[model samples]
Target: MVYIRRSNTRVVTERNLDFKEEFQKKLSIIEDGLKTYLPHEDEKPEIIHQAMRYSVSSGGKRIRPILAMATYEMFDRDVKYILPVACAIEYIHTYSLIHDDLPAMDNDDFRRGKPTSHRVFGEAIAILAGDALLTHAFNVIYESALTYSERMKLYVLAGKEIAEACDSKGLVGGQVIDINSVSIIDTSEKLMDMDIRKTGCLIRASVVAGAIIGGAGSSDILYLNTFGEKLGLAFQVQDDILDYKENEIFPDKPTYTSILGIEGAREYVKKLSKDAIDSLNIFGDKAAFLRNLTMSLIDRKA
Candidate 1:
């Protein structure tokens, strides 16, 4: 049985309005950082650059980067130090989305209410754009780390965490399993293994990376890792529930709702959400923002 930490400290410590306002401020910062970091659309080899810019500029929750920044904030106040790595995580996420939407993959026509990279830029360019983002992210990480000569080692360790999370040991491995196991994903164990690796690893990496950059102690990092994993699973489960509600769930594909039923899935989301918030108890009131954010995710309408 998974241990769920219970705290007398409530999750709703902050007002909804304040939380939303703060979240938007962070979102705006992330948007600016992304634009700053990405290549200009008019750069030489214009098409790939444009495609890259287009996909990266496209709107999303920016949750991964925000998570990293928030985790860093728990220990350090100057989030600028974590900005490059945070944006790097978003680049990785965008690259995955671009590749996932290709004809060879999910064959999606749209993302974030806009045309997908392949749909707008054609398949070859989209593929190249994704590759560019993936490669560029590492450069950003490396170059940014050099700026902080004193904490260079921390940056290297954090970058390594990000790399492993997205490579064969994590996201890619899970994606391979997902693509191949449509028919074989019969048990919750198998399904969760895929979900944790595909989705949880990066989220976990984001939190852990932030903690590392912030100079967190090993035990603190361990707690944050658990928080990220629980939150990641809860986030995906909530997505499954929302997809079901919207009639967007593919019948042939296995999902939490399909495996556990809607009510069961809802209950699972609640449990995971609680566990995720509980994992933040070590932060006390300093974690109010993250705790509220965690609650908001499971309760989100969209």
Candidate 2:
């Protein structure tokens, strides 16, 4: 087994940073960080701040940040140093969801069981809120401190990874294909490509960024990169399964279930999930949370 050097040792205080509790602990930290960094409700231009806050505060799993911290923790890096970067990921994710739900986009009326940002704040406010959240993510990352000297370079590298993921050929590109692929995606490979870009890109960035912050070696970095991509794809497949069960309004959209059937998609999820777990084998027991996370993500209900 290849050993990773220059990584943080696990904090002595937390002996059991594994299982369900670890997941909740990381999620709670991310949730609080998100709330703390969001613009105040009474800040200048109250309406915009309110809209942005509303969007960020809306309930969700906060998985992106969790992924970042979990990866960072696996390398024994102090999670505090990476919190802002992790939070930045959530901001970007929230922005995407808000914009995706707008009238010109997915046109959804609800998110996390509440009215969507646009539905409550109007289309213009929702658009601005998404824009603000996206900008805020980068701004926070740029302004936040990196504890290590090499972290500056790592920051730039990881930031570029995230930016590229958000670019036209990644997140937006995936969404564009989502809109256009109903007729184009006849094969499982083609559909998986679209899913990877839209969902897997950001997820990959989350873990990749964490590894960078933790000073992981090239081999470990490569393993985590593959893990993130496989996990991200599994995540999207799980979402497709959920949508198949909970909603059917978008029958026109291409999904794994649409092409592979529910049983087939479930089997696909198991395959991707196993690949993700295998990716962590290089890390040994240090990756318990991440390995379990892969299973939890697959079994998620909401």
Residues 157-269, model 1: lDDT tens digits: 99999999999979989888888877879877888999998999999999899989999999999999999999999999999888885443536778998788788899999
Q: State candidate 1's TM-score.
A: 0.93
Clashes of each: 0, 1
Q: Please provide the root mean square deviation of candidate 1 (C-alpha atoms, Å).
A: 3.6
Looking at model 1, which ten-residue stretch has the lowest summed lDDT? Answer: 1-10
The C-alpha stretches of model 2 lying farther than 4 A from their native spots are 1-18, 145-150, 245-250
**Cα lDDT of model 2 by residue, 1-302, tens digit:** 11223244553224334366777888888888888888899999999999988988888888889999988887765777788889999999989899889877789999778999988989998899999999999887876645454467877777888889999999989888877787788778998889889899999999999887777888999999999999999999999898895444436777788778889999999899989989989888888778777877898887
- Would you estimate the TM-scores of all the predictions? 0.93, 0.90
- Give residue 279's error in model 2 in angstroms: 0.9
